[model samples]
Target: MSTAVGGTTRPCPECGARVPVDERFTVWCAACDWNVDPGERQEHRQKQETEKRRAKRPGQGRLEEARRALARRHGERLHTEMTRDGADLRARRDGASVLAYALALAVHGVTAALLAGGVLCLVWGWGGGLMLLGAVLLVMAVALRPRLSPPLGDGTVLRRADAPELYALVDEVARAVGTRGVDTISVGKEINASVISRGLRGRRALDLGLPLWEVLTPQQRVALLGHELGHYANGDTRHGRVVGSALRSLATWRYYFLPTPRPSLGEMIVNAVYAVPLLLVQGTLSLLDHLTLRATQRAEYLADREAARTASTEAAAGLMDQMLVLDSIDVFLRRESNNAALAGARSARRNAAGAREGGDLWTRLAAHLASVPEHEYERQRRAGARRGHSVDSTHPPTHLRRAFLLTGPPAEPAVVLDEAKQRRIAAELATARAEVARSIVRDGVA
Candidate 1:
């Protein structure tokens, strides 16, 4: 007997895979890739062509052109700086790389001097009351240092035992890159990986994005992890600890120095008078921040170089491309996944199995991502490439990184997990995925 083609009950005639009928009236078996209509293919091609033409219109390239010009200018200076810095590092002087550190020290030193001078004035100045006021101003300057900690993402910490496969990979990368091994690993929903200092001991914590892991090939995953771990080896994350502390301190001091509460006219006068010295400190920090921005960008390139060395350059470039896609859609996908999970939670028991891909959140997300057409992905990739290396941007432009990677000698693939191992690693994270999804929904990622 011949199989029917129009209903969910029937399978595809050629491959016998289930062909679920939908309102679109396009008959096909997605599982076995059979019986796609010619009209549908033609329709898709036409739609893509139309979108492509629209994207290439005259005004479309205007902003990109301007950005590229600016990027070229910044790239020239960056090339010079990185060249010099690289030579210095090769000479074993990276620890003393010129930074805004000196300025940060100066800012703190000035604050202490002001406080000490104010104390002296309070003891012996012309008027005791005026000197007391000066002392208070100086004290406030020192107390209100910028103190924001880096954001610890909303997710669960997975110990080495819990994610041994991942920890093993971390160990391999750490050994290859010659950096301290990660002290802890956390699974989070971010579309990016980050290495953060965990405690007073500065033990490195590695945060991996589960969604990011889902999309990347094993080699690309190595590239991603290697890139983050590379930061430690390259001394970029270390510099971050130094500069970040200073920047945070400046912010804390700025906050205290800035007037708080609703001040009456008389109080406002006093507050404004006190703000004069505080503004100088803020201005000095701002200038230092401006000067050091390029150093941060160069650090990113240096880290990329390390990743390319550890993982193949191709994998590193592929990571940059994938990251562009993630940056574009991560929030949207997270919200959609949350919505799907919430809906599934409210469904009948029978409907639970009916939920897409056996009610797996990651599977549902993969399906949603698969629905984005190739051209849309290309569009975002191109857009990211065009954003150009701005001076203030921490990461260099994706195109620039790709270009730099291509210039280097090709690297052997550093990490490759067999298919079974990849599946095993993913299976180990199944429970964590559920926990993370619940966290996302609980935290209301949307």
Candidate 2:
């Protein structure tokens, strides 16, 4: 009897005997006493497992068909509305939702009231116990106030001095989109780009992911820059900062006061006592989040239209398609690379080597993806299609977006880049890519 590996069966190298394949990780040819090393067997099993999981999302074919039909029926009108009036309308409504402020006020006001009541209770016997509880509640509320800004993890700032050519392009896009330029540009180790506010002052910080930049065409680059800058133009970032901060604060408040049950009896009793009031707070915030969800999705569409205006219709649609595919691919590749790197590191440690291989993992992964046959790529894409009408989703579906762009009015004074400038931009991005790759590999090993 011959033991086998999980992957495909092949002839044994030593004796030319057939090797059986099964669920076991290791392959052994009993007739020839042949076997693969443990590391090779482990790697082969992981690749099979990864491929199976990567292509198994519940497909969205029916949902996509419905969206396609809807786009055919009303896409022109929707595109017209989005291009002409959507951004302004959304900004106004978001500004009008000042009632979102109630979430923050309710939390702070109730906490202050509790503290005052506790002080008043001190006038009576047994007030000390009540006062002690109130102080704890007050401290929790104060601690729960959200951080004024999002964390910019491991992102290197791309200053104007660092790349004047890139800044010139960014400034050109900002001007075309009718917005002031970003305060800073940072390159990070992920496949995403966005504009974030730095603090209460609402300083605009633009983030460009190196992985994303490396794969984008020049026109797609312009489209993405316009879309992000459009958020600033239409006040999305400004209003979002306030509403989003409130939501985070409310969530933090709940976590401290209404934690999930623990084994300890004392903590459980405290959680039970605080749960009811925190429930009210969470309910109120949840309602506000629901209302904002629609606005946020609309903002994304409007920004896409803005990108079309600043760049070309083709460029905008290309960028949207890239996003849809890149998001899923990034997740899958990042995980696989991290796992591979970790395995190599462990192997090196056991062998007493100072370092492991698999440097520039992202570049290697990108090359492999680029080399995939068109038919195979399409199959993977269809398998990963997102479900339609994700109510909690922040952006509209990619298919709908592409359809709208196809039907939308054309832009005047189209954005075009000279070949030299395109080459220059790509060179600048190569440096950023190298930096992010090093960061990713270092973090993976650590």
Candidate 3:
């Protein structure tokens, strides 16, 4: 399926339905959607494997199911709470927030304690062992320090001088969402967009992934800005330095203590010594994750609500639809990259060098997405509903987010992007877009 489409058609193996497919892409039946989600079809095999594993370990399957059931109940309750709260996050402060904040402080306290203890061991305690221990603790503390290593680079930054229209659009969206606009805008290679802060002054930057931004309609782009800026308006615990850094520190601690596969005798002894600390760090991280789960989910929901209010509910829903079929879009890119590689390989055999076609990656991407049938999008939605997945693990399930939007009161576009401004924004992104497309063709998707 690496070749370009429009060469042939074939019958679906599942339902004998004629589907328009070439050697170019996933041959799923348009009629019955056979092979649309191969993973769903493996339920029987998964159940059999589960049963076989369960025979060797009593109650394992039931235990896992029970945990899932418990988590599902928690999610339902949180959803109901968010629904009752509506889009108003003003009075949403509760025990969970306080607990999360307190835990974050405690995590930071551990780091401080490490630093303090290290100094004591080095300067006060007079022993070679103590000095060695001090050095180790200092290294660990430094590794766990909370710092904002910039997500944007110098070359990638899109100055307001360059993209006044784009920056103006974002500023307008920020006003609609009840927050100040970001300091800068940057386009990058990721198929996602985010608002990140840098330095002690906390200068905000809106980083847009060219692929994701290109695929979005102008109004949908408004929704994207609305959502990202909404995070700034609605402070997120998980995104905050205290809790966020604590989670990261725990992750670093886990990495340091992780067990290695195929360990030598000395390594085995080391792992045995590290196992308890590893388990403790992992459990701490899990506790932090659980405590902040609903907070993060609520943050995303509020962001979505802001998106709807700013860009209109229809456009917001359209943006959500894009997220639903992100997998298909990604698959299409990989397919395109693979085809380019194959073509280059064949050419190299003849010309003594591989030469990849470039500059049309964005055009090809837009066409591939535009050409996706409505039914395919429907299939993706249904699959998402079944799988209970979201754009990010921290966010609520896509179906739930969709329902939250559709079931709410609709809003007209508060921040509209007229055709003229739209074109100006496109003009601003043109050079960055072309560069991203060429990079994709050259390096390909990871």
Candidate 4:
């Protein structure tokens, strides 16, 4: 449990122990970790009751149990290997990686062949239908080619000139993680943050989810930065255009191949015709996912370590605590945005037509976060553990990542957000925060 560092003392509601609670952060008893993720309620369920929603067949349960056991073993082995070499954070490739790469290359090669064949068909074919088929093939080839990511189109964009202090902080964190800082910062309403390479030039852009940012403390914020910057250092194959786009294209193909709902007689035949191609697409996706998942997970762990190292371990842990309440945050945002109390005030949304500020969504969020009782937080944590949820399917379990942080090497903050810099950064984000708030208030923050 994180002993509160620089915050004022407050009486713990649970044990009445004096505990330090940081402003705008997790308000929990440091002594008891009372409001922190307390797992499993003591209450028991009826012996006869079962969550036994049976699968398609009788033996399915046993098969699933075996699979779960195998997955658990695999996860344990990878965890052990990752922790084995603290200094070496590179995702070690096995035969699977090589096979995945070969498959990706083959996919690209097939696309090239399709384009060439299409051109040849167009040149040689006399029939209009043949020419049309050639044109379709060419289009498919072009569509399936590896491509760069496009602009998010939403969120307020902040450049170096717009937020010098924020950029300076990001640059410092990036330097710590051994990556050139991002060129642009896009702040939005989501409860997540990430760094992505944008455009053909691969300009790194930091996407800061404002709701997530507002709730974290200064050092925790630095840890968040560290985690994102560390992705740049850790080679994530899922982010690579070649493999990434290949996966996307396969998924797209699979979508088109899906059987028509409540199929007519002709549609049934059509579905049967596409069945093989659908299976091929699915199998390829599975192969690529299985190969890249371990490495992606490793990258996430390494990033967590970087977060712990760059910001302090305490802060990193605290950040995890904040993460644990993300569902709560989302619920709170949605509820508050739809509140009858705020309806009239929320009606006047800020837009391009005339910019009007929001109803201080961040402030309400902070208050809601602070107000969440220990019992509720405990319930959420326990539920999360049972769920074994991660940030994504590619990530390790949230509880596991939190445990990893605490067990990892401790470090002093290499990039601290002092109050002065914090205020300046907040000033930089104020307009955007208000914009996001207005959007949420008007649209109910989906």
Candidate 5:
């Protein structure tokens, strides 16, 4: 039988063993395990053969050699072009992170300083103290906000294994782009998701509500996760958290000086003395809160782009569509619940009317105060009343968020998806919905 190696025939160079002529040209000598330069050997052989043939047709070989050289040069040029494009993308991403950090810090510092100044002015009996106080209170509320942490395990692969298919999709996209895996995936009742990061270390996590799972298709879920993850990838979490904490501390200081209802007259007097400064503090906090929220809005836009980059543009659009539908459903539910509660409250008031009218002057005054419009009341009173608490909460209004996500400018590289993938996603979504329904039914039975 004939054997071949390296397209040549020769005696074995490494050993005195008699081998097939073709096998002697192997890249590695079988007997001694010595390495051979295949390319160099092939080139040497070609050159020798060409030299032998050159005597017959020297001009003909030149054209073939030149064509080979041209092809190598073209390949080198293409490789260089690809490398330059990759570098340009990296530069742009880095620039974005730098800009986001600067904006976050500036907003935080300005808000804190304004709040301190306002409090000082209020202490000096400034006329705008009340307004200042209100503003400061608002700022503190946003700046001092605490986010719920999503629980995650230690191992990345293991944690991902426990996640839903949507989360897995997020992980794949992130890994493909050489970004960090999502920190956590939490299930909540509301149809919402958010990314949060804290401390100087930049520890981040993502919260995804169970209700959102029910509402969104698989592709939409992937897009939403991509958006939240993008915020982390963009380094928004750590910076945003720092800004929030600073604002909160300033607000807390202002609130500390504000008077609250107490049993002792001396305490009331003491609180009253600090009222002006407290009001100013409140105003400063409010301004900070407004700025923070605005920054949040911008971050949201950036995140949307990131999502589009990780997933398809259509996936991003689908996410927005699902969010809008969920918001509408939530609004309807809230309105219905509110109407029911109001009716129940009216009935309770009617029942308590006879008993409430029969009290001492102080008691009657307290009862009358409780009946006052909540929106016009002091912060403490409004908080205590608990009359439709959701309306007064921080976080962007749902309708506005949905609108922005749907219509926001494309700010990152576009991703593409095909019809087969879309079909598979739809099938997965159907399965998820069925599983959810089964679980709900099982729970009801139990």
Candidate 6:
């Protein structure tokens, strides 16, 4: 028998070795599982065998390699396209922010003018004074509005003085991305990390909370930071601040006209007199908030893509999963806290009963106040408290985000785990849970 190599065939030197030749001049020996080369006389035989193998294993190694090369090239192309798209988005957002600021200033200017006119009208006993006063109050409320800060900034660097391991990890990631180190890092109660830009010129800062440090694994923490850094890389932080400020201003103006109780009888009189104007202000603010939210949603999508690009998609997915788990834990804790509070209230009531025999004047007053229909008020109060929580909740709902990250392009499949990746993800989850348990044991979370 003859085998072929490189367009030639020759007799196999090794007897009893099964020599199979191919058209491409490749030879396979079955008995010894080695390739053999036979010189030119067997070339026709070699070609026929090669054709058989090609038919049997269509588009094997070389073809697969070509496909992979094409995919890598495509990925590079997409990265470039996305980078340019991100730049365009940043430019557009910057313009929008400037426009919003300008509009806010214009509104403020009009408000100032109206207030001046109102004062003059007050001096002259003009009927327009009330309308002008309402407008002025609305503007003041809008101008001084407060809101949850946007979750963007250069994150605080974990120092050796604070958390050595976390600091080291953050430094590693920062070096990998070739960015300036996080500007600041602080320990906070909420399980969140954010990048914030401050001052008129927007100096960047990173703020990390203590709960995240206590809860997340090093991988999870790095992933979370990468997501935030993605925001920074895309200039989302500065633009987010502008959007947040604009939304806050609108919300304030809306609240000014809404039916919240007045601080005093005189204020109530003024509010009642100018209710219609207040409603208009509130309506306008609500419209602005809707628009800002739309922009915010787009920024979130871009940031997610950036995170996936910089880190692995799996890492981004892991971070989002961790966020959802943390959110559930927070909700559970909040409910438990509320229950504890109710128990404390009951204990206080019993103590009051013991002290007063039945009910004293103060107790009766408290009972009467509690008996008033205030379900809406209580709900609003709770919502306000949740808003005041230090956690950076600027992102959309967790479940929605997870779905977005997990689903990738259909054509180029992601690594489908055959047990190993699944195990690793499970181990990570277990570690996170253990950390949370340990933190609870040590700190006795309230």
Q: Which candidate gets the maximum lDDT versus the true structure?
A: 3
Model 3 TM-score relative to the real fold: 0.85
Where does candidate 5 stray beyond 4 Å?
A: 1-161, 164-167, 175-179, 235-239, 251-258, 262-264, 290-294, 331-446
Candidate 4 collision pairs: none
- Per-residue alpha-carbon lDDT of model 3 for 77-164, expressed as tens digits? 6567667744455525567878888987888888899999899889976666799889888987888775544445423678999999
Locate the minimum summed-lDDT window of 10 residues in model 5. 383-392
**Candidate 2 lDDT for residue 357:** 27
Judge candidate 6 against the unseen true structure and give its global Cα lDDT, from 0 to 1.
0.48
Instruction: Put down candidate 2 lDDT per residue, 36-79, tens digits, no spaces.
Output: 33344575786577556656743454454455565443433444
Candidate rank order under lDDT? 3, 4, 1, 2, 6, 5
Candidate 4 stretches with Cα past 4 Å from truth are 1-59, 84-88, 126-129, 150-153, 264-266, 340-342, 345-357, 373-392
**lDDT, candidates in the order shown:** 0.65, 0.63, 0.76, 0.74, 0.47, 0.48
Clashes of 5: 14
TM-score per model over all chains: 0.67, 0.67, 0.85, 0.80, 0.43, 0.46
Better candidate number, 2 or 6, judged by lDDT: 2
- 1-446 in candidate 4: lDDT tens per residue? 24544536768888988766545445556456665543322212321122253333556556655656655666666666666645466646667667777888777787789899899889888576689879988998877655466448478999899999999999999998887899899998888999887666888888998889989889999999999888777667776666766776677777878889999999999999999988998898888887777778878888988898789889988888888789778887777555633535433332421233255567778888777555445545555555453322688776677777777457778888899999999999878887888777656654
**True lDDT of residue 46, candidate 3:** 93
lDDT of 5: 0.47
Tens digit of per-residue lDDT, candidate 1, span 244-343? 6667677666765788579999988878886886887689767777656656666777777777777788888888777656644566555655555566
The numbered model that scores best in TM-score is 3
lDDT of 5 by residue, 63-168 (tens): 6566445534433342233234233222122343455445546546555566665566566545665657756755764554333232342211214445455455
lDDT (Cα, tens digit) per residue for candidate 6, span 1-446: 44344233444456554444443223444344333222333755765776777788986645644644654443334334434422343414545545655655554555566556656555565465465665565555445544445444322343455554445445555554444456455443355767666555555566765445434444445566666666656555234555555555555666656655745888787778669877767665544543344344445655665555545566666566555345434544444334444544675653433333211222332333333222222222233322231112335544445445555541121212234543443343333334333333223243
Those runs of model 2 whose alpha carbons end farther than 4 Å from true positions after fitting are 1-91, 94-138, 237-239, 335-386, 412-414, 427-430, 441-446
Evaluated at residue 435, the lDDT of candidate 2 is: 57
Minimal lDDT window, size 10, model 3 = 347-356
Winner on TM-score between 2 and 3 is: 3
